[model samples]
Target chain A: MKRLVQALRNVERHYLLLLAPLLVFVVAIAIYPLLFSVSISFFKYRLTDPTQTKTFLGLANYITAFQDEQVRKALANTLVFVFGTVTTELTVGLGLALLLSAETRLMQFIRSWLLMPMAIPPLVVGLVWRSLYNVDFGVIPYYLKLLGFDLGRGPLGESATAMAAVILVDLWEWSPLLMVIFLAGLKSLPSEPYEAARVDGANRWQRFIHITLPLLQPVFLVGLLLRTMQSFKVFDIIYATTAGGPGTTTTVLNYHIYTVGMTFFNMGYAAALANILLVVVAILSILYVMVLEQRQL
Target chain B: MHRKSSRLAFLALLMILALLATQCAAPPAQQPAAPAAPAGEEASQAPAAAEKPFAGTELVLASMTDQYVAAFQYLIPLFEEETGIKVTLDPLGYVDLYQKLTADFVGHTGNYDLMTVDIVWTGEYAANGYTLPLDDFMERDKDQLALDDIMPVSWTLGEWEGKHWAYPLAGYANVLNYRKDVFAEKGLEPPKTQEQLLEYAKMLNDPENDFYGIALLGAKGPAVAQDYMVFVQQHGSSILDENGKPAINTPKNVEILEFFGKLFDYAPPGATDYWWDQRETAFRSGKVAMMEGWSIARAGYENPEISSVVGKVDIALAPVAEGMEPKYGFGGWGIGINADSENAEAAWEFIKWLTSPEIQKEWIRHDGAPIRRSTLEDPELNQEYPWFPVLLESFEKGDGDYRPRIPEYSIIQDALGTTVNAYLVGEMTAQEALDQAQAQVEAALK
Candidate 1:
């Protein structure tokens, strides 16, 4: 017994032993749910109906997902939301990062002030925007009316503008995060390259395009990856604001999964929908990593 | 070789520890039994004798954070004092409450001793055995409960398959609320027919001036479906036929949808995006001249702090189709004991005290919707809520089953809600939308 105890103590001296708890936790919480969801995706399961046996349907659920018109629409909307929020955020974030990059007191103050929206919770942002877009008493519509914009029943009330309105909320809440990341990326860029570019008579736009942007590719990739994934899974803001309303224009894939899983209790179909989303996100992530790796090379 | 064996042993130890920890953290296999009333206790015992039965017992009630729940909070102290039982109110939003209640019931967690059930959930909850049938308890205390005093329509909401699974707490009948001042100024009486409603709406609509004829629930999901049902039922149509088959694409339903589409023109620009709160806000803010809303919102209209149309608003039965009988929308919350609850008897005691006649009379003063016939007919309550008589009349004619109390109603509502919103927004014609909804609901039912 003493020999065994001594041997166990010696084995614990390895640093990998310290990681066992974290590894076990990840397996239990993360990997287990993922595996369970994947398995359930192959069955016809309804959580609310206890009498219905969880019959194995093989790939039928996945096939049904491909044929579902609502799923298709949700996928299209998710793509639009992801592309819309990420590109706009990048452009707006890059501009703000450049503007605030200068060493000045006002810039520092403005930088700090810009982060206020980021500090606010996303759900709270949705509620604030909902109030701001209220036609009867919202401050935004009141000003737009004063400015003669003919907002014709606030922005969120019209399908033509609801998706854009939701995207703008996402931009307001998340653009600051990207801006801070880009600012750090900018500060970390070697100053010698910018000085060399200026010596060669490069213009401000030219220097930004040639030196700053190329050097910031990795940070841009990280921002794109994070924002795309998060924007695809956006349920809170849409739930708070439109609830995917005005003719399902803003019903993204995650919202569809929620309606199916929670409202309808079609657990198998919801699982199938979830796994398809996982695949889409996984592919996007892999592409981002490959591009990042190539850029590093 | 020695190191590898020790490493394997250490890994095995870690696995055993994890399993042991999980087991330790799990809930006990059996819940503690509730304290029973003393044997040989006489039926004529004083109130204090009954109070000692459940002393020191705690119960958790899962409920929605609504005006009715606020009233419950106000009345809970009286119950605690009378029974000496501690009560914890777990208030959640409507959707959150449904999700949490289902999670607790599905897992048989017994985390909640009581739950607030929507009338529409009766079939689902009872069928799944999530809630305990209150018939035995009602039978045991029928005299004290005064079950017959509850309005038939209200009490019937708790009945499914000839079993009582819950007790009615609030009876909300959807009634038409109109601006009295505006109608008087325009020399128009409240519309009694569908055609007159449209005409009145057209006359009242002045969107350029931010005044709309009506406020419509255009938000996608249950709100739109519920609003559509109010129109559909008045037009002598139902989402499901007598045989429980999808009847949404019938001619009458189509006509109702077409008329509803036109009514949108007289509503606020984003009326299609409005929910209950938005519709109420629009009416209270005087943006809309009229709206069909639940009776619960009636009290809010009388509060000057949140309403600009307090003294200007009056309630009436929802406008009906010409030659059709008036049918109001019936919906509200019912309090039910969790079947897995260890403290069900104590929970029932709380429910009984909450719904008793004397407490219900006091509850109405705190903005609780009346479910009892006695409370509805009380002269003082009628004076305070001038619309009480109209509400009682509507309740007599109201049909809670209009939305289909079947377990499949949620899926049907989802299909109908999406399609109706699509039609209203011009994404599809009425025919196309109904056809699509019919197909979706049919597939869901299958």
Candidate 2:
């Protein structure tokens, strides 16, 4: 105890040594900017005119963001996107993991190759898909025609199909993460339960459900939690593909904030919108953690 | 003893070389060492001349990535020789340029010494004092700027309360662009009036054949505004009334809205989504027979590299409305001085030389837009770039002087954009959407 106290005293003596770099970093990047943003959020900051008087209406900016139709649509779109992508990715990813676990060497090679999709930058993937979905020259329409489908070209960025298409891109890019987690979970599963089930003359399906899912519960929770967080923040691919276009059909919440904050320079309103986004993400994160904790209990 | 003396000599030589190296490297790190100057005792020192010679300084200028590179690498080398200043241009996309300039001004950093700002930013920027008033520069060198040279409207965007703040750099406005071959094939001359345009659009509508009569920009933000201006101006409907209230919901505007809505019947399938580049691409790819677009597309239309329909494109005056005057679309570019700049005089000289009629003619000759009135009408210059003279002639009928130049213009435009978008997407009836947007604009003003 005395030695520990001395060590603490020594650390305190060199506290500047410990804190100087961190203080410099945080103050430079995170802490100062956050305070600055919070300050600006109270004032109406216009990009073209900084000298323009900012209205100090408390909560008015929040009210504006909440009342905006575009904001409402974007929020709904964001929820749909997060829910749709996260759910579909987990199911398909777990299935692929189970299937791949059957074969060893071949599956290893295939697993490595399949992850190249994730390795590709989202922008390049979007560009590649844009070309493949082009009305004039895309491969999908050509193949569809070959298969006797008269479906015209230009399907990716039109109507509600665009929302589904961008979601599919997210699924393709991120589902590998789910597969990796499940693969680790499957490999770490104990053999005793399966042996006991075999001794009891239990079938593969019954044993699998009772054993595999329960055992992989922690991994599944982690994957879903991580993915739900990321899904709520999807912006770049959507921007590169459609620019929230065809009359704001595919505009998501993040893109809305970008256009509002950066494009229009409505700093106060944008900050309000950002705070709402932060709240949503925080709630989703806590819900995931609590749900998993409850299941554990 | 002799070997010891040789070692002593070697040590002495090494010490001298090290001292020389340290002294030589000190100036670069210690002072604003101008790269254009040779290494000397005076090289690292700031200029002493009160004439404000630009010879030993470096400036960063911002422009579009495409032809602006040519302007920097090719056109400015002679300027470097004449002025002794190193000009480095940072070229970016048009949208990127807007965002960057907006951010730079808002951040109060003013990192850019000069930037080619869009005309829309002028009024808003000037109102806020983000840009420098060009009065001092003009007064200092009255004869040099030849301030009366450029066209009046082009020059006016840079003005705030009778003070010139920015130089009118280049003029780029959309006119009616059509495929001559397509018009000939349909046995239809280019549409002379709004009703004729609708008829022509219907005649050329052949979606089954993978072609559409008319293509247009209907995307959100500035896209919808650009397309709507020609129509609204054609009907003599103003965005702001005499009392500074929203006048966009007037009967004239309603007729214009109805006319555009009817145009939807013959428009491309996803016409509501097409922006500037997409509309141009559609026309170039032979997918659309006609598009009401800008003079910026003129050079692209003539270039075989960018367009497949080269030599097949023609420009026309914007179609006239029945009850209103014919109006040409307003799209111009401008340059300005930073009010807080330390080297205001040098910046002024650059502006004057750049916008001079002699240079504008050279710019027009080399894949750049022209802003000068005389250059547009110059016989030889006109013959080379045929669109220049035609564009000037079209401007004669131009009572359509439209662009949201006020500080609240962006707010009004956003409301207008949403209204048009809602109406077109069947989200709201045309009248309802227009009324709502007008109400929104009214509230915004308050």
Best by DockQ: 1
The sequence of per-residue lDDT tens digits that candidate 1 reaches over residues A1-297 is 666556666665554478677857865786556766887899898878846457799999999999999999999999999999999999999889998999799999999999999889888999999989987678998898898888764688677888999999999999999999899999999989889989999999999889888999899988898889788788999988888877778999999999999988898899999999999889878987887788669
Q: Highest lDDT among the candidates is held by which one?
A: 1
TM-score, candidate 1, is: 0.91
Candidate 1 local lDDT, residue B223? 86
lDDT digits (tens) for residues A1-297 of candidate 2: 454334334443354466557655655566455555665667665545444456677777778878887789998888888888999999989988998876679988989887888899888888777656655446876686568755431455355476787788888888888898899889989999999999999899988888889988888888888898888887888777666754566778998888777766777778878878878888879978886788669
TM-score of chain A taken by itself, candidate 2 = 0.88
Weakest ten-residue segment in model 2 chain B by summed lDDT: B29-38
Give residue B323's lDDT in candidate 2 (0 to 100).
57
Q: Place model 1 in a CAPRI quality band.
A: acceptable
lDDT of each: 0.84, 0.70
Candidate 1: TM of chain A?
A: 0.90
